[model samples]
Target: MGKIRIGVIGCGSIAKHRHLPEYAANNEVEIVALCDKVEERAAELAKEYGARSYKDYEELLKSDDIDAVSVCTPNYLHAPISIAALAAGKHVLCEKPMAISEEEAQQMITAAENNNRKLMIAHNQRFVPSHVRAREIIESGEAGKIYSFRTSFGHGGPEGWSADGKDSWFFKKEQAFIGAMGDLGVHKTDLLRYLLGEEFTEVAALVETSAKKGSTVDDSAVCVLKTESGIIGTLAASWSYVAKEDNSTIIYGEKAILRLEEDPAYSLIVQYQTGETVKYELGGIQTNESGGQSNSLVVDHFIDSIRQDTEPAISGAEGLKSLRVVLAALKSNETKKFAEI
Candidate 1:
């Protein structure tokens, strides 16, 4: 209603680097509570935001002062925390890779539906300026008859991005579930669905712990996905990009190939088969490797959805569908065959 009362459920790196700061800056939101298993982390962010700190998330959810919460907790806790918050009558903005399984994800969606509260997944890549523009071009038939694509997202590792650094739970299999596939691959999964406007029907994957020593979960994965439209693409996610990060996508169409975030100078470029190329200087992507500016476009959109009393752009059902694609990839890795999504 009046300046949405916001509570942050995790005080780790995402909360530090993105959620907390972004929420604090939003005029439509007021940071009312902060929570983390680490008391000091919660207290530190609470002190700065003029909010209460809680070691227990249930306490934060119990407070009527909060109208909504951003669930930035680890992968294992996403569904539980978001469902709890929703059941407590709080709108939820959950971090990506919605949950460990499609069933868990569905439960989270059901919770939101039962509570009549808004639920938005923080798939921030869709908010990137160049990506938004690329969607426009593709939809306009400029990138005609898109038949193939290759998209990748990679960086040093979660240790460099998480607030807990190398000691972060991100590497732990039990806590983080699927590693790079969960952390980075899902973003591309959702992004491709957004760009190609199709759902992945089947996938074949090689999930491996090719890099990183501490974690038992996979550190890298290469998946071949065939969308409902019969469009095929390679989706690669890795935590071993020691040289640099590559958050680029090439959408191949009959007329031209649209390259996104491949070059730093220009965020998007279209190379036509007619021996012509067009480059646009849209802003770059914000990744641990790239080191760029990123706004809380996802957060802002969530708030807008709340105020307007409408469904979020990235609703629970939408998130569930994307997560299913990821689960299918994991299954493919195990089965050594194409897995149906």
Candidate 2:
């Protein structure tokens, strides 16, 4: 019950940038082991963090000293590794798009539930300061009766962020399953669900592999989502923004138009119907840029959940709900119709 012993099951970009460092910084956690398919990668990180290393995730999960694991692997490997980690009596903090299919996400949830361990999805968007404030403002009726929204998350692509650069598993359809939608769109979807407190019940989308050359997976996607209460919104996810990253959300409501992460100076801006404009200088949203390393709070929250023996804020069920919206968007693209979630 001292520091929660942690194992990170991927030595990739996300692990390097977010999980590993965040967990190491937390006073309640210890970086116990590192795992990756590439032995050198795992070994290097292990040496740096003073932790054990394993080329095989299964081997890493066998250690009883490890109380929790961050499943930072490719999308295809997320479900299996997390399920295994849960079965091994360790809490799991899985990366976004927790599974490629609903069945797999359900199985992960079932495994965690059966094992009586915590399962949290690493949807750090919810932990963004502006997002948290926006949710509060919306719930307090500051944005009274939401009408519509437009949110986007884009950048040059994972080539600049992935550990393998242009050769990362992110561009492969088999490994990533879906690219921008799963990578970026799901964050917005989850954010919207959190901010609005409603599940997306239908989706229509145009998903394509348009931007990245020679890539078999989608690099851009635009989705039209309808919430359970008839609130509609557009979500754009792309790897084609060659200049810079854009992670912004604009919500239109009866009393105000709330903008999040849209201004360079202010993180949240609210323009009321009464001509009063309020701007908030909350901390910057985390980006793939060189020095935009804001604390995402995902790793800390996961550690707290384990320590307190409580369900994580972004639990498996919440992740599954977000995943379903992404899956429905894919289905809508394939079927050329509105897909009900």
Candidate 3:
């Protein structure tokens, strides 16, 4: 249980901007290896971190030096690489939209269980201070029974943010599986589940590729999600927000309406029906615009979980469940009907 020797797969934007920097920041982590199909990409980070680089991730997984890994690959590779890593007896912190399908997600969970290695998903929204506080408030019954909510995550596109720029794999349906729904929608899907503490049982969706010019995958999507408890909400994910970003969530409760990331100053605000307003001055949620700041905290918590021998905040099972919602939404879009999870 000394410092966790970490191997990072995929030196993409999520790795370059978030995972690499965050892993470096964690004192309990010693970033030991870097891997990407693009050799230069892996080597650059290896040189920067004073670690070994491998173009083939399988080779990196074979290394005895690494005790854990951050699977930062594209949507298609998330499950395969994670299963291989878990089989190699290394703990994993896979980036989200955990897998393309729920079956793959289940395989990941099973692999982690069989290997007795921790499997955590990089659902960083759960770590946002506003979200954490909101969960606490809702749990305290200060917000009362949550009846309905609408949460959205949108931006211009992934061109500016992805490691590959305009020609990023994000635009390729084969590599990314789904578009905005995979990139942004799943974040809200995971966040809503965290906030409501309920499992989404059914989904009806309107998935579209109307805005973006080149991608075959969806550019905009609006999914109506209904939980087991009959709690309903609208989840919107888009790459078509050319004017501005709208990464906000509004929850309607019996007592008050809790608004998250709605204002610049107050990250969280609650309005009671009794004509009272309470604003929390917790810092902003790290948006794609603000860059990935809270990502370090995500790495920190993962390392802490390893050190403490505890389960991660977002376990593989929970991540799989979230993936089911997303997959169901995609199904609903395809079938033109409600999809059951």
Candidate 4:
């Protein structure tokens, strides 16, 4: 009823850039614990937020005062940390690419159900105002029957953001499992699912490590997706995009085409088949200071879900759905054929 006592696991880039600052800003939330394998990082964040620090996530999970946790760990730790948090009776908000595999994602979902706790994924793109407005316009039938779509996200590499610079877990296959697909691709996967309101049924993909030297994971990936509703689309994610595009989606329908961009300036351009164009200035949706406003929106939704005893905008099952699409793309790349989701 008061503030949701929160613990943040993995005081890495995401935690520092998004979760910690956003949670600190939420009036209904109080950060009580911070955890990271690197104790110094945890201690640093804790001091900034006036919270306790722990080197072991397990120890943080066992704390009785903490009501919820934000799992900002690498891809591989998502399921384990989430499952443990649920078992410990704490609500969880796990970062994207829910798990390395669907089986692990399912285990996390099952754990949440079994524990009767909230398990939401931090797919923050859903909170982007341009994205939300795009959904509204599409659902309003202004876009008509959806025909196809395309979306992508990319950056120079993880060196700029990863705590370990070039030696971060992002480049390690053992820790990250997949590369740009998991890091940047997953955002588009979830964004498309949210904007189109359709589940991906199949994917044909090509993944490669062409740009970053010494990086074992994929540096670039391009994939085509077939949605259950018969809509087709392509998603391209890369860590090699020298220009650095955040995330963008374009949807083509019978009546209109919608283009949404998150960088330089947030804007939505809609063009009708009748040769009329309408532009929506989405700059207001641009979160102030490091996209923290968007992060705050997402964290606010999670807090509201807990307070209202309802499901979050991005639930665990929804996270699994997006994860499935990413995995299907990987499989398609491996087999060099369309893989059914």
Candidate 5:
């Protein structure tokens, strides 16, 4: 009850760069164990954080000293590890796209419900200052009813981050399910939903593996989405951008258009039809690390939620809603038509 004892399920790049460091910074949390299939990686991170290491996630879950866990494993392992952690009576923060399919996502939700534990998805974009500010402005009727949006996220690929480069699980269909859609696409999809305060009801999409040859999953994809409230938007995500564009979203409304960029240098801009424009200086908003400011904010939110016994900003149900959008996009691509949510 003093400090929330935590365990990390995967000692990969995300864990090392984001979750581990953020957790360590939070005085309310104490990292107790690190787990990874690669024993050396787990040991390395454990030594760095002054925590115990385990090759088996199950062993870490069995530890009574651990009150919560962060699941940073490959896409396919998300649901299993999360379900196990919840069933073990630990609060869980699972890295996004929630799960590859709706069925798996449902199982994770049900397990958390049955165990009465907090289940949050790491859709860190929701925690970004620019995004949070945009949501506030939109909700205040300052934008005057959002009509449309365009968003994108792209990068050179996982080669620089993953230890195995193109051979990493990100390129494997069995492990990752979909390539760019699950990786970069999910973030934008969730962001669009968050900014608009609407759910995606249908999607028309196109997907390809043009950039990364021999990759089992898609390397690029674009989708058109129709929200339940009649808002329309486009989302494009790719692992093929030559110089790394990160993520950005533009929202159009009757009175103004708001533009948000992950790059702090440009900050966020809102242009009103009445010939007035306002810009926010987001000095520390961008970073070379994946998720960047969003990750740190999300980790802080999770720790606060555990301490306060409140639901997270991005709950399990919200995560499932975003995953449904991605799945619908994939289905639309395969069928070459609009797919309903």
Candidate 6:
């Protein structure tokens, strides 16, 4: 009903860059609390936003002023904190790679159901202009039946982007669960599912930690995904791309081929089998470098869902489906064989 009182649970780079700013931008949101284990970080943001600061998320969840929370914590905390927030009768907007396992993700969904609170995942790629247009083209049958695809999201590393810099929890297996796959890979998997409108049935992967010295988690990974309709594709995520960020996807269809975020001038391109090409000047996808501060639309969407009493576009169940793909990829990597989802 009134402005949605928001509580941000992490003051990391993700919160600084995406969640906090985006939530502030939404007129329907009033950020009432900021929390982080690092008290100074939370206090600094609290000062700027005029919100209360807490080092413990449980305390923030107890506040009657907050109606919702953004779970911007690390991979491991995403589950427990989200479950707790939902149980506290607060809506939750969790960061991607929802949980370390399917069981935990399912628990989150169940928590939301039991509490009658919304549970949304911050899968921002679904909001990108190019991706929205790509989904439109494919679903319109203008691209015909999808045959294959290859999508990738990569940047130098999280060191420059994470709040803790080189010592960020992103490099710790206990904290992050998985590295590049969790950070970047899951974004592509979610995007692929959004574009294809199908669930991945099988996966084969080669996940490694070849780069980023002393890191205990993977820095590079390549996974082959097959959809329920038998369409196949490759998904690549990496922290080893030292040059520039690459957030591009190419889809092959019976009548046309679509390219997304492949060119600096145009974000979406379609080439018809009839010797004609079309290019769209949709806005650019946000990257890790400069000009990456664009709105992700996740925070606003979460608030909108809560306000409208509707299920989020990226609901907990939708997030769980995408998480299953990443988990299957990890299983495939370990077994050295195809893993069924």
Candidate 3 on 305-327: residue-level lDDT in tens?
Answer: 88999999899998988888899
Clashing pairs in 1: none
Task: Determine which window of 10 residues in candidate 4 has minimal summed lDDT.
Answer: 284-293
Query: Of models 3 and 4, which has the larger TM-score?
Result: 3
Off by over 4 Å in 5: 262-264, 284-286, 289-295
Choose 1 or 2, whichever is better by TM-score: 2
Estimated TM-score for each candidate: 0.98, 0.99, 0.98, 0.95, 0.96, 0.99
Prediction 3 TM-score vs. true: 0.98
Which stretches of model 1 miss by more than 4 angstroms? 290-292
RMSD of 2: 0.8
> Cα deviation in Å at residue 37, candidate 4?
1.2
Candidate 5 residues 1-341, lDDT tens each? 69999999988877888899899888898999999999999998899889999999999999999999999999999999999999999999999888988999999999988998999999878777888889998999999988999998888888667766767889999998889889889988888888888888999999989998888999899999999989998899898887756688899999999989844565689999999989887644444454543445778899888889898888889899999989998889889989999
Candidate 6 lDDT over residue span 71-114, tens digit each: 99999999999999999999999998999999999999999999
Error of 5 at 50 (Å): 0.8
CA lDDT scores, all candidates in order: 0.91, 0.94, 0.91, 0.87, 0.88, 0.94
- lDDT for model 1 comes to 0.91
Worst 10 residues of 1 by lDDT: 287-296
